[model samples]
Target chain A: MIARLVGDAAGVMSGGVLIGPGDDAAVWQPPPHRAVVVTQDALVEGEDFRREWITPHQLGRRCLAVALSDLAAMGASAAWCTATLCAPAETVLDDVLALALGLREEAEATGCRLVGGDLSGIRGPLVVDVCAGGSVEPERALRRGAGRVGDVLAVTGTLGGAAAGLRALFGRRPPAAAPAQVDAWVETWRRPRARLIEGRRLAALGVRCAGDLSDGLLVDAERTAAASGCRAELRLEQVPLAPGLRTAFPDAWGELALGGGEDFELLLAAPRPLLERIALDWPPELAPITPVGVLREGSGVSLYADGAPLPLPRVLSRHFA
Target chain B: MIARLVGDAAGVMSGGVLIGPGDDAAVWQPPPHRAVVVTQDALVEGEDFRREWITPHQLGRRCLAVALSDLAAMGASAAWCTATLCAPAETVLDDVLALALGLREEAEATGCRLVGGDLSGIRGPLVVDVCAGGSVEPERALRRGAGRVGDVLAVTGTLGGAAAGLRALFGRRPPAAAPAQVDAWVETWRRPRARLIEGRRLAALGVRCAGDLSDGLLVDAERTAAASGCRAELRLEQVPLAPGLRTAFPDAWGELALGGGEDFELLLAAPRPLLERIALDWPPELAPITPVGVLREGSGVSLYADGAPLPLPRVLSRHFA
Candidate 1:
């Protein structure tokens, strides 16, 4: 089809492309002394986001951020990104362009360039897919597969804040909905920061096996444990939930604390012997780094509250079904 | 908000990804390679495609193939890919899943891995976007700026077949509508092959200036000339048009020959001296490569029929105003 030619030509020539759009494939070279790491993700309106909850600009930023965070988790520095948007003709072209501008700003803020993107008129929900490229030295890279049986599982920043903030946006009375907590949670939820700096710090410390908590403590932790082939038993007493979260929705608080997604915090697995060194640079007061569990030579995730196993939540996201 | 976390975490890392997603800033390591080239593109039903014209699997393949063609023209390879799809809910999940499977198959056909991607629910139209990556050795990739004066412009495949096929699909009478020509044109248009092999061949031959003909011949040639700061003059008689195309639309044959798009052929410029040595593999039968024009030391594109300047028809596509 015409598409085959379009696809083939865009990636054809192997070399001699200072910047080719087609040939066998495409090639991108980052600066010297750096290896490129790539990441990609897609977002669909209604399922992944809502127009009522996010502006186009915010959506752009979020789309870019998610892909960027993958690089951060790998301890790689973002260099360039590409975003593709599919929307209806009735959608404001100006707003869409503005969203691209916002992406440019956010990427530039992180010293990354928003190099190129694609826009198309489609009949379904608006979709944005982003690809982020970063430069990282092989030695300093981190991976989810590097955790050991004895590594200590620590998290940076507060947990459940994003989930709590979401509840507020949805008009749900989450236990963490105390006025002050809600404000804090909403801010965290709306634009959770990317822990790029911490990733570099951890990398420098020779730490590996790290991931950002996007699918809540339970799901993400399970992913890490599964990927690393280890078992993790989280201590609920040690699990950090927003203050008053338990008091408000007494029944669901534990569920939110366990399965609430979108915390966006980094769940790191490090050797217990290095705890003192890890705590040196990061203080509990500034970005509270808490250890909630330990890895073991087994499988499955177990959550304990007051020394008893709690019932697992039936659903994680409303859109999943 | 959760999407923000997903976006931030799924992208590249920079030293400043502070609590990225849920933290302050994320930390990342700088790799050994720098300078990256990126591109993105999207597809939508009705505007660029129609379900009646192709199968869902073919549609998915075409969507990615078309976007990757841009990378091919840049002389690169696919390092990774991210795709987004938006379709109606009533649509069977398996159908969409089949599309994903097709995408994966196409990706594997080319030598890249599907690192990560996203999927979500939507309402009416079906949309997809693909972002691919390629790595170039320092100072080896080609760009659109290298077309020099006296360069011979060439193409890798036949032209107008796709355009002719479009007419045929709609039951329009065209010169190429005769059984033999119509079959060739329709088949070519339905699954136009990517000239990846030819791109590599050209790259090995040291051909520098090149681009895919996503737009019609005249338009893309003009773009190459304009972007390269040179004038291009093409002899109309030397232009290639499917045989049936001449027979089908004989009155406006020249317009269709030079202006109709969606051919996906590689319209490239080669140094003058390489013409003879380069043409040995031009094979006039299948994908007959031809020299239709020469880059001049001036600006703008001029057409010649029997050594006299000829008025050219505009070949254009939908672009945001």
Candidate 2:
């Protein structure tokens, strides 16, 4: 079944892929002298998505994007990907092919070849797992542990929209007047864009510490801090919320923005000097970079509002604090 | 959860692994100037194995072995692997950890690094998917399409043991007198070994066409034939039967040996001269090779018994022919 998917994966030619699916494995050549940054991520049916909320095609694109987000954080070029799909026996072949097509489209969008994968029957919820990798110059790849004590934290694009979209997807019918904004939020949740360009730009600008906002700000912030041996002091007032997120869920926007997760945006930390230079040369069309926090000589993450430490939220879940 | 597994994956370090699990992704430096062979394979709970039948540790080992088999077929030296697990929320942490330990053990045994992965909640049975890769010499890796019409087909190791083991596990209680052999067969099914060494030997010996017999001899032979644009002709009488398989089930041995998948053996097509040379130099420590078939100027597969064309098995499954 996996070998057959190679026929459907008619993707634009990428430089490194020497063999695409249908054999014992796919073979590729990484650029000479470049280190490979690899990551694997998965989305389960019930836990990650509801069938009624997202089409198979969208789910396909979303899965690839989610995995690619890690490569984005590493500031690696999109090169190749392999996906494993475990679906029920009753699943229609067309659905499987549609999912493959979704993967192909995403690969085309990112220039990552959908090289090879495995397919198997499952007795439960659908599972799509993708392993993505790309090349980065040795010793220059961004890492979470590379942050410094005085590094300022900045993020690509806004946050909380995907989480808000998830809430709206469940039971929170948006205010009728704000239906359009809610739809856009839902779209953001459905189709995530990996910040590949911004990540490269940051790396080129000499930003070495970075990670993706897959689990939203609070968790990823705490993680980056723990890895970098410092504290993430997030200034809530300075954090940029997704457009209309504050207006749609005025009471819960803070928690949603901090904890809602599913935002494929990147959070980067660099010396303020580099951050200033990056800001000065940042392209106007790219997702606007906004200062959100700083790495201090502490541990974990501390939330502050108006320069005063705000108590951590009771829980950073879909329910919002 | 994936980040936590990195703590459990204390593995024997192989060269080129710059990073292991944890962080957003794992970083690795492939052998400089070597092409990479990447493959992904998955084992879904219930469909692939019932928890009652195999221990979590064995399942973990099996999953990694299954994915590694593809790399083995490519004659790529195993380098690194990433696993994604989707387990029910009710799953015990110890089981998950045990599974990770299993993966680590297999990686240690094979000299592959269990570098990184992703963990997620699933509403259904557990699913473990692994993406494994290794470096191969550019333009030198074995491929299914490299066979010629007149090449004789040879397989490493005996066939049908794992499939027969599957039947034995399913209440086909082997003849009580053969309990010891039956037990060994069962072990073969529970713990698969990728023929990595033999594959590397084949490549070193200049064998260009080979693939793992994961879906049994019939399916895999057909696939290799199709990929090479030729027909496969097998002499059933010369084909190897797993030790004790023929005696245990004389009537079904042919079908089980032909169609029962998961053998994880390698089938190769090479010129007669190369086969003779390989046989002379084949190591006694490795699984014995047996010539069972030949590639011909046609499509599909033809089975012969005592020099007479034999009808293909009615069905190649646990039920036998």
Candidate 3:
């Protein structure tokens, strides 16, 4: 059965993959003069998703996107990925095939290839672990430790949509919003896009420090700040909320914007001048880049609203606490 | 808790790892003129192992070893590894820490660094997935597709040990073997070594076709044969059995030798003169390399005993079927 799945998924190899699936290990001839960026992310059933909320296909695509978000955080080009799926023996074959198809589709969409992976039967929750590898100019690669005290903190795309989406997903009653509005939020929750192009653009535009907003803006910002020996001072009003988020959440929009995780957006830090220049020359095709904060000469993260200090909300961790 | 474990296991980084754990992704500077070899393997709670049979530390080491074996099969020098562990929320934190310690120990022993990984809570079972990366000269990397007709089939280290060890583990009654002998088999089952040095030696000796015998000799040899478009003919007498294996399972020794999986040894196909040369130049410090079979002008694998064709044993799949 494993061999059959691999065979069915064969012949989709991209250039540079010397040996794809069906080998002991996949070999890739990486492009010369670039360092490899590698990251591994796993999503487990119940913890990462509920079957009722996500189709197998969406789960597969989301898993790859989550893994690739790390590469994006590193400002690296998409290259190849390997995935391991641990499912129960009772899992439907078509569901597994659909999951694989989703993975292949996402890989192709991102200019990456699913070169190899493993499958196993489990007596536990379904687990999808993906290891993504990409290449970047070593000196130019974005890093969390590169943030400067005076750097302007920026984010690509609007935030808080996934969190809003999650709220809509688990709400006892349907959201008091238009059907299209509810659909948009649900879509954001189901299919968050990794800002790969925006990340590469940031690297090319001389941005040094960055990370993906998988753990929400506050936690990820704090992490970047801690890594760089600085503090993240986020201006709440400057945060670009997803359309209708303010209207949907009203009282909790601030918490959602600051703490809602799984956004998969890129958070970047660069000098004010460079950020201004980037904003001026940023391509319209990519997600809009918004300056939402600044790196200050301190440790930890601080939030401000209307020029007044605000206490950080105690948001529950989305995964294992 | 995750951060604490990562920090405690820190400082074991080897050179070439630019950005290790705690970053969004790990970055490594690969040596010039080498292709990257990557492989992923996962172990589930009940499928790959049982909690009673293996300690958390052993499980961690085994997971990394399983992944590194694929790199070894490609004759690649280990560089870095990332692992994901999904445990139930009720799992003991100490056990998780011990597992990380084991992973660090094995990675250091293999001259690779633990770069980055993910952690999540699973409601069902424990899952550990490891991804290993290494570098090898593209022209010299061993591949199963390189096998040719008339090539001698060889393997590194003893066979049937893991299978015998597994039998000892699952046996309801104590085996008739001596306690010391039982201990050895159980050890082999719990801690299989990846033949890194032997694989490199084979590659250096110009042997191209190879694969790790994780699925026992018969199955892996058949896979190699199928991949290379040749037939594998095994000489049962030539197979080097684990010490006391025949004495332990007299009637079943043949099946154990031919069908036992989890051996974690290398199966290679090379010309007779090359095999002889390899044997002559084999390093005394590495695992012993022994000739076991030959490749013919057909497909599939065949077994022989005392010059008579023997039927292949139907071995149950060790992993998910």
Best by TM-score: 3
Model 1 complex DockQ against the native: 0.31
**Tens digits of lDDT, candidate 3, A4-55:** 5544435755657877887889888888998989999998888888778889
What's the true lDDT of residue A14 in model 2? 62
**Interface RMSD for candidates 1 onward, in order:** 6.4, 2.6, 1.4
Ranking by lDDT: 3, 2, 1
Q: Candidate 1 chain B — worst ten consecutive residues by lDDT sum?
A: B16-25
User: Tens-digit lDDT track for model 1 on A124-161?
Assistant: 66777787777676656777767889898888776776
TM-score, first chain, each model: 0.85, 0.95, 0.96
Per-residue lDDT of B54-110 in model 1, one digit per residue for the tens?
A: 777777677667766665665554544556666667878667766776676776676
Model 2 misplaced regions, further than 4 Å: A8-13, A315-321, B8-13, B317-321
How many pairs of residues collide in each model? 133, 3, 0
- The DockQ for candidate 2, computed on C-alphas, is 0.70
Alpha-carbon lDDT, every model? 0.66, 0.85, 0.86
lDDT of 3 by residue, B1-321 (tens): 555655543464455887788778988888999988999999898888888889999988899998999999999999999999998888898899999888888898998888889988888889999999999998999998899999999999898878777877786323667878877878887898888888887898899999999888999999999989999999999999999888877788888777777889999999999888778867788999899999999999999988999989886466723
